[model samples]
Target: MFGIHDLALFVVSGLLLNLMPGPDSLLIMTRSATQGWRAGSAATLGIASGTFVHILGAALGLSAVLAASATAFTVVKLVGAAYILYMAIGLLRSKAQDGVQAPLALAPLPYRKIYAQGFLTNVLNPKVALFFLAFVPQFIDANAPHKALAFIILGCIFNINGTLWCHALALFTGAASRRVKLHPAASLWLKRTTGGLFIWLGVKLALAKQN
Candidate 1:
């Protein structure tokens, strides 16, 4: 009725796509582990907001510019890579307690900051903008007069499902961290592990070429 097609398939595909490990997944899981589920939720909301921007941008045709321009893509990619590496460095050097001489560690990161980080991390990645341009339109009806609305509806559905999955991941990771924290220096190791992953993702993003 809304010029949406094969919505069941889209829903399944979106869930599967959300399952793929990336910065988004890593942030929420690590935040939940170190902070709490609330922090993860903030990150989820921020990421969702960023996805909305991509959806709107795609519907408004701004994403086409990214698709057509290599320089634009490269600029966004490098900025995103640098941000990821920045976060990686923080995680790498952070400690589990708030000490006078220690790095920002497992102590609670402000929800606003986490939210902003989530937004930046998701929005700065040019690949995500490209994905919206490439993926969301397939479900939009070609003959529909309100293609943008249809695109938005589908994007919201996709984001909603993604949020649910992220919340689950946060809860599970938080719970697991409690158990893991029983071991010696588990928190530090987890932070370092997450930092290593961010570094790998950062380098990968830096090396990404426009296709």
Candidate 2:
């Protein structure tokens, strides 16, 4: 049976993992800085909701196939890469039109679209699915009598930890962005940098080896 100690360990691991700064974190930061805390928070919720999807898929053994099949992994990775590249392009275009001096305002995006963006950003990443498959199982001790319950408990803990840390980051960065709103040039450069990072990550992920 899972206990509080296990929960503590899981939370610690999750928090540390969140601090490591991956694609999801970068996405949250970019959206938060470019938009606002509300948008960023929406994206975070989307990501958390996406994690639940992964958990369900993993529980159903769909993620195992994703891990095992190189073709499937590549296909999903390419799709994610494409999406990231598309975002980069959008940023570049926006910068060109806005002359890098425009104030960062929350774009008039529908709430559902914002949420879906977050969900798809996470769900599209094959690496995330693979990570869940590889990471979640280790906490389930073979000796534990209720393996399913243990997996679910640990997964939920991880999701909650991730959401909390990401929300904190969004709040911090969103607030800072407000102070720097006048520096459109700076925002432009930041967008370029963010775009570059996303593109690079997409390329790296595309070239990653399947486990």
Candidate 3:
């Protein structure tokens, strides 16, 4: 069991991290703003599922390989960047129509595909593996009876915090779905903006050095 102080700090830190805007959050927002609450929720769940993989990687020392091997890190990073860029291009090419009913204008794609997109987006980023390797260990107590168990617990806390925030954002976007629906131009701009963000993120990821 972690000390009460450590546990409290972990929760606070986890909450703060989840609040910080990043690719994961952006993906959820884009899906919500452009699609609907259901799509956004699916993306959020997929991202959370990917977090579990990173946590397990960290626990099993697999993340350390990513941290230590520049080649592996670069390979994963480039692949993630490429995938994100592909998504951006798709968004950019989407035709906007007049009288579009906002978020619901486009027929909802299968939730399974959206989920896979979110999951792949998260899992392919080596930076996430590195993040877990660096971030989670800071709160781990060397004197703890079961370090691995503590890691798992703390990682779960991080995932839960993130999921709550993702859902909150999705619901907020859902509430605005009707309003966005009323403005066709606004919907087009939303897609473009989201697409641009993805482009920037892809470039950022491509340039990132292993940390």
Pick by lDDT: which candidate is best? 1
Q: Write the per-residue lDDT of candidate 1 for residues 1-211, one digit (tens) a residue.
A: 6767768856865775676556787788777877988888888889988999888887767344454554654465466567667867986896755211211236677999999989998989997887676556555444455666777888989999998998887777677664422122554565667677667766765675444
Ranking by TM-score: 1, 3, 2
**Residue clash pairs of candidate 1:** none
The predicted structure with the larger lDDT, 2 or 3, is 3
Residue lDDT tens for model 3, 17-125: 5654557766776678778888889999999999999988776663444435546544654665676677578666655563244343435678898899889999999
lDDT of 1 at 18: 72
TM-score of each: 0.63, 0.60, 0.61
Question: For candidate 3, which ten residues in a row score worst on lDDT?
Answer: 98-107
Cα-lDDT of candidate 2: 0.64
* Ordering by lDDT: 1, 3, 2
Error of 2 at 137 (Å): 1.4
Better of 1 and 2 by lDDT: 1
Against the correct fold, how does model 2 do in TM-score?
Answer: 0.60
Q: Write the per-residue lDDT of candidate 2 for residues 145-202, one digit (tens) a residue.
A: 4444555677788898899988987898788874432245654665666666556655
- Count of residue pairs whose backbone atoms collide, per candidate: 0, 1, 0
Error of 3 at 196 (Å): 29
